[model samples]
Target chain A: MPLPTLAESAIIVGAEADDWRAAVRLAGRALFESGATLPGYSDEMIRMIDEHGPYVVIAPGLALAHARPGPDVLADGLAVVTLATPVVFGHPHNDPVSVVLGLAIKSAETHLETVAELANVFNDSSAISRLTTAASVAEIQEILGNAS
Target chain B: MKIVAICGSGIGSSGILKVNAERVLKRLELEADVTAAHLSSLSSDAADAQVILTSAEFVDAIGPTNADVIVIENYFDTEELARKLEAALG
Candidate 1:
């Protein structure tokens, strides 16, 4: 099955997040609000980072925060949160991320298409730049819609 | 040659690395098969790869392998990756 696109309700523009944890929370909140994930999903993401490291900061200015699929994931979901001020993930590379893309997958094998599409979007420098400056959820949706 | 990109989950950051690696390989005129796998699966998945590219954090987790492991500081920079691939594959 094809992965879902960036939901309008799951897009947070100009979000106020003081640190990476707050940024991830803002992104995870969108997923929860959209009924894609259960509560505590955000905390789990942070915990994973703390245990593993900052590998989630996939690109120079972007992060794709996620935890393992479990009861917390109601369905496969994607959320995008653009921070008003970029926060550092303490990564030697890809620090001070301005956008966080939260993902909730039902299973690892089921979300390859979604992750591939997301990687394509992120690989495009212009798309990442536009996403960073996107003013509203509608704008972000339009950008993603156009990409698809 | 076979190459694999690895990450903690294999679906997230490693996917990005895999894409970048493909681009770099194409530009370098190198012929290789590239795959992405989770850190947990690297022991089995990386056994056949000639090279394994991933973040520095996973170097120790990957342990000792026959493949030449390259620690990429930046996954987004395909130019640097191309250079490194040339150096490794040439």
Candidate 2:
């Protein structure tokens, strides 16, 4: 299966959040508002980071936050939150993350394609730049489309 | 040589590491196969690999193996990954 396009409702541009947790919560709220996942899904993401580390800061200025699939996820979903101000994840190499992509997948078996696609998107320097300053959901979607 | 990039889940950060690893190998003109795996699923069988790259948090989980486990603090820094890979594979 190919990676699904991020839903417009799940994209939050210029989100205001003082820290990484609040930024994650804002992204989680988008997923929740879209009925993609249950409440507290964002908290679960934070829990994973707290327990382990900032491994989710996959790239410089980018974080792909997620947790295991369970009751928290109603369906496979993705959310993009571009912060007005960057927040630090305390990752040695990748700090001050400005883009947080929230993922809520139904299962591990079904997430390979989406994850692969996301990796491809994040790997592109130009795409990352566009996403960092994307003014609207449409612009973000266009960037994803171009990358795909 | 075979290299595997491990993360909490095979699909996420590991994927990023794998791509960066591939780029590093290509730039160095080194011919090797690189793959990604979940930290929980990695085992002694991975001893066949030349190197195993992952975050520092997972080093203990990887345990003892014939393969050299390189703890990468950042998965996205291809330059750092290349530097480390050269030092190891050379």
Candidate 3:
């Protein structure tokens, strides 16, 4: 199945965050604003990073923030936040993530499928840069395979 | 062969790892059943797997396993995954 449809409201462009925690929190806030997760879900995402190190920096300049399937997830949704200034997450290879994706998954299977789908988009290194430099929400939506 | 991609929750980064591994494996002209799983289910999910793919952060947490646990540097970098996977299973 296709990844959760990202709403326009959930997209934040040219967002400013002081650090990785704030950057991730912004993505979680987008998820919350999009009606995909509860307000506390952002903290859970932060907690995961605090516990596990910066493995969430899956690729150069990219970070996908999320937690396990939990009650906080109201729906399977994805949020995108482009940082105006990148922040380091202490990753050895991939550091200073500018793109933070907050994902709220209601189930393990479907969310995994979405990841596969998302990989197709993120696999292109240019697309990742575009996301970081995107000035408009529509550009991000387009880059992420969302027309709207 | 069986491969497992593991993460804290198994849904986010691990899922990305699983997909990237499948792509690399296909490019390498190799076939393996790859699954994404959480750290909690490592024992059962990766029991029979020949290789386990994950980031360095989880290496200690993975503990001891018969399978070779490969610490992936970048989940989206096919170059890194291809090099490591080819070196491991070439």
Top model number, lDDT = 3
When summed lDDT is taken over every stretch of 10 residues in candidate 3 chain A, the lowest stretch is A108-117
List the candidate 2 regions with Cα displacement exceeding 4 Å. A146-148, B19-35, B44-48, B60-65, B73-83
Which candidate number has the best TM-score? 3
| Highest DockQ model number | 3
Model 3 lDDT per residue over A1-148, tens place: 7767878878999898999989998998899999999999999999999998898988888888999889999999999999888899999989888899998889887776788889889888788899988888888888989685
Q: Which scores greater on lDDT, model 1 or model 2?
A: 1
Candidate 1 reference-contact recovery: 0.44
Clashing pairs in 1: none
| Residue-by-residue lDDT tens digits, candidate 1, B14-35 | 8777877887788778889989
Candidate achieving higher DockQ, 1 or 2: 1
Backbone clash numbers for all candidates listed: 0, 0, 0
Q: TM-score of predicted model 1?
A: 0.89
Residue A41 displacement (Å), model 3: 0.4
- Candidate 3 segments whose C-alpha is farther than 4 A from its true place: none
Worst 10-residue lDDT window for candidate 1 chain B reads B71-80
Interface RMSD for each candidate model?
1.9, 2.5, 1.0
Model 2 Cα lDDT, one tens digit per residue, A17-88: 988889989889988887789878999888878877888887778888888778999988888899989999
| Ranking of candidates on lDDT, top first | 3, 1, 2
